[model samples]
Target chain A: MADALLETRALTAGYGEMQVLRDISLAVQPAEIVAIVGSNGAGKTTLLRAISRLIPCGGEVTFDGKSVSHATADEVFGSGLVQVPEGRQLFDRMSVEENLRMGAYRRGDRRAIDDDLDRMYTLFPRLSDRRRQLAGSMSGGEQQMCAMARALMARPRLMMVDEMSLGLAPVIVDQLLETMTAIRKEGVTVLLVEQDVHAALSVADRGYVMETGEIVREGSARELESDPEVQRAYLGEV
Target chain B: MELLAQVLVGGVLLGGLYALMALGLALVWGVLNIVNLSHGALIMLGAYATYYLFTGTGLDPFAALPITAIVLFVIGWLIQRGILNLVIRGPMFNTLLITFGIEVILTYLAQLLFSADFRAINPPYAGNNFRVLGITIPLMQVLAFAIAIGLTVAMWLFLLHTRVGRGIRAASQNLVAARLYGVNPRSIYALTFGIGSALAGVAGGLYGTVSQINPYIGGPLTAKSFAIAIIGGLENPLGVIVGGLVLGIVESLTALYAGSTYRDVASFGVLILVLILRPTGLLGRTT
Candidate 1:
C-alpha cells in the first residue's frame, strides 16, 4: 500500500465505436516489476495506452499522487510515466545517438543527460558501435535495445514497456529482461505488457493475466506460475 | 567553355535559391503530410515584406531577412492555429482544398495591396558581379545562394541536434512517441508551420533580390517547388540541395540548349519522369 505509485481505478477506454478495455483497475508499487500477460486482442496494450493517455480514457489515473485523467501524453511523461510503445517505433532516420538524445526530450538537466548517455552505452555496448548509424539500419534486437535506452533517457519514475520480447532472439529477450531487472534495481517501477506468459511471469515480481479486456487473475508471480489454471491456459502445462 | 561554366554556375546558384523556396513546403509536406498549396503565396508575401522593409525603412533586403522571417512565421502560426488545426485530422483532400483556398486568398490580398505591378529588390550590390575561378557570379545571387545553403544546413543541424527540432522530427514519425516525450501537439504543430513559413520568407526575400516578383508569380513558383521537393526526398533536409541542384542545372541547360521558353517543359518533364520512376523521391526511403 505504501508503494502504490500509480493506480488506475475502473478505467475504461477504446477506439471509435468499440470498447477494448472495460473497467480495468491496476496499480504499480514503487520499484516493483509488474507484468501484464495476455494473448493478442486481450486489451493489454490498450490498458497501457489508456494509462499513458494516448487514447481517450475514463476513470481516474493517478501517478505519485497526481491526477492524470485529462493529461496529454506529454503531460503523462512529464509526470514520470513513460512508455516504450508496441513495436520498436524508433525514429528511423535519426542516428542511434540522436535517438537516444531524444529520450531526454523533456529534460533540462544537461549534466545528468550526458551522464545517462554514458550509462546507456555502458549497459548496451552494441549501441556504442552503431551510435552513428541510422536507427532503421539496426537489427530488430538492436532497435529494441535502442528503444529501451531511449525510454530510459527520460529518467522516468514508472516505465511502461509494450511487447518488449516481440521479434527478438531468445538470447536477446533474456538479455533485455536482465536489463529490465537492472533498471528495476535502480528504484524505477516498471509495467511490462507481454504475450510470452512464461518469460513474463518468470521475471515479474507480480503478474496479471488479462483475457478479453478483463483481468482474470492477478497475484505474485510465483503464485500465478504455480496456479494450475494459469499453467493450463497460458503455459500449456495441462 | 566559359559560357558553359557560367551556365553551370548560374544553374547551381539558381538551384540553391530554388531549394530554399521548396524547403518550407517540403518541411510541411514531410512532417504534417499537408501539401500546403498556399506555400508559394506565403513566399509572395515574404517578398513583399522584404520589398516594403527596403522601400519604407531603407533597410537592406538581406538585413531585413530576420524581420521578414518573423512576420511570415507569425502568419503561418496563425494560419495553422486558426485554420489548419481545425481540419488537420480530417481527410487529405479537405486539407488540399483548404490550402488551395488559402492560396487564392493570399494571392488576392497581395494583388490588392501591392498592385499587379512587378517589383524587384535591387540593393546597391544587385548589379555587382565577381569572377570566381574564371566564371562570373552576380554578388546578389551569390549572397542569396550562400544564405540559402547556410539556412538549409542550419535547419538540418537543428532538427538533428536540438530538443524542439528533435521533437518535431519525432512527431513527424509518430505523434504518439513525440507526445510521450512531452511534446504538446497543438503548439508543436504551430511551431513547425511557423518554422516552415520562416524558411519560406527567407527564400522569398532572396528570390526578390534575384528576380521579378508579382502577385501572379506564386503559382509557377509553387509548381517548381513541388518538383524540387519530389526530386530531393523528404527524409533529410539536405535532400533539398540535391533536388534543387538537379532542377536548377536541368532548367539552366534547357534554357541554354532548348530555349528559355522550354525551361518549364523540361522541369515538368523531369518531374513526371521521376514520379513515374521513383515516387518516394531520389533521396526518400524505398520502403
Candidate 2:
C-alpha cells in the first residue's frame, strides 16, 4: 500500500445521465501484475477508461503521487499511466511500422526510441515480418501483439491493458500472458482486465473480482481462485 | 486534331490545380471529420491575399504563395481553436451549419473589403506560352500544375514521415488510444485544420493565375472541391490528383463537344455516378 504506484478511491464514472461505476476503488503497486476479472457489462473497461480519463469520472486517482482524477488522457499518459485499450485499436490505415512509431509519440530521445523499436520488433517477430503491411491487414492475434508493442513504446510506468485475451486463440492468450509476466519482471507495473478468470488469476500476483461496477472481492490470486463463489460465478469449474 | 490536343492539355493542367484545391478539404474531412463547408471561402481569402500582395507589394502571385499559405494557416488555427473547436465533438450537423455560416460571413466580408469586382493575377509571365509536342502550354498553367503536384507529394511525405503526421493519423483512427500516446486532440485537430487551410491557400494562389476570382466564388468552389474530394477519396493524395484529372478531362471534353453550358452537367453527372457506383471513391478501400 505504501509503494502503490497507481490508486483510485471512490471513483464514480459513466456516460451522461447513466452512472456505470459506483464507489469503485483499487490500486497497483510497482512491478506487479494485477488483474480485474469480470463478466459482460461488469464495468471492467469503464474502470480503465476512468483511470485513463477517456470518460468523465468522480474520484481520486493518483499516479506516482500526482492527482490524475481530472487529468486528460494525454496528461495521464504523460504522467506514465497508460493503457493498451480494448479491441486492439491500431491505426488500421497505417502500416505496422508506422503504428509502432506512433506509440513513441511523446518521447524525444531519438536513439532510445529507435532502440525501443528494435526491442519491440525482436519481441514480436510476426510484427517485424509484417512491418510494411497495413495494421488492418494483419490477423487479430498479430494486431494484439502490435498493440502491446505500441504501448511498450511509451515506456509506461503503470501499463493498464483491457481484455488481453478477448477474441484471441487460447495459445496466443497463453503466449501473451507469459509476455506480461516478463514485462512486469522488467520493472513496469501492469493492471490487466480480462474475462478469463483462470488465465487472469494464473498470471496475476493480485486479483479483483468486479461485478456490475464495484469491486466485490479483492485478495491475493490464490484466495480468489480457491473461493467457491468466485469459482462458480466466473471460473468454469463446478 | 490540334485543337483537341490543346483542349486535352488544358484539361490536364487545370485538373492538376483542381486536385490541389480539393486536397485540403479531403485532409480536414479525413482527419478531423469536419466537412469544412467554408473550405472554398478560405481559398477565396488566400486568393485575395495573393492579389493584394501582387497589387500592393508588386510581388509575383506564384512567389507570394507561401506568404498567403502561412497567413491562412494562422487564421485556420484560430478558427479551429476559437470557434469550431467548441462544437467539434457536438455533432456533424453543428459543424456543417457553423462552417456554412462562416462561409456566408467570409463572402460578405470579402465583398465589403475588396468589392464585388472580379480580379486576376496577371504577372509578367501570365501571357507567356510554350508549344510542347504541338500543344500550347500556358506558362502559368504549367507552373501551377507543377507546384500542385509537388505540394501534394510533399504533403503525402510529411504525413507519412513526420511525428506530428503520425499523431494526426493515430488520432483519426482512435482518439482514446492516441491520447495514451500523449497526443492532445484539441491541438492536433487545430494543427490539421491549419495545414488544410494552408493547402487551400496555395491552391487559391495557383487558381488565381489560371482564372478570375471574386468574393462570391466560394460556394461553387466549395461544391466543386467536395465533388472532387468525394471522387478521389481521402486515402491517398495521388488519388485526389486522379480524381481532379478525371473531372477536368470530362469538363473539357463536355465543353468542346456538349458545349460550355453543359460543363456543370458533366461534372455533377460524374459526381452522381461515382456516388451511386463507388461511394468510397476509386482508390478508397471498402471498410
Candidate 1 versus truth, CA RMSD in Å, comes to 1.7
Please give, for residues B1-287, the per-residue lDDT of candidate 2 as tens digits. Answer: 99999999888988999899899999899888999999999999999999999999999888899999999999999999999989988889999999999999999999999999989999987999988888888899999999998999898888878999889877877787788789999999999999999999989888888899999888877888888988988867677888899989999999999899999899899999999998999878422
Clash-forming residue pairs, model 2: none
- What do the candidate models score in CA lDDT, each in turn? 0.91, 0.90
If scored against the real structure, what TM-score would every candidate get? 0.96, 0.97
Tens digits of per-residue lDDT, candidate 1, A1-238, equal: 5458999889999999899888888889999999999899999999998998889998888899888999888889888898999987888878899889989988999999999999999999999999999898899999999999999999999999999999889999999999999999999889999999988888899999999999989999999999999998889998
After superposition, which runs of candidate 2 have C-alpha atoms over 4 Å from their true positions? none
Q: Which candidate ranks first by lDDT, i.e. highest?
A: 1
lDDT of 2 at B216: 89
User: What lDDT does candidate 1 reach at residue B34?
Assistant: 94
What are the per-model DockQ values?
0.57, 0.67
Give the CAPRI class of candidate 1: medium
lDDT per residue for candidate 2 within A1-238, as digits (tens), equals 7568988899999999999999998888889899999998999999999989989999798889889887888988888887899998888988888888888898899899999989998888888899989999898999999999999998999889999798999999999999899898889899999998899999999999999999999999999999999999988778
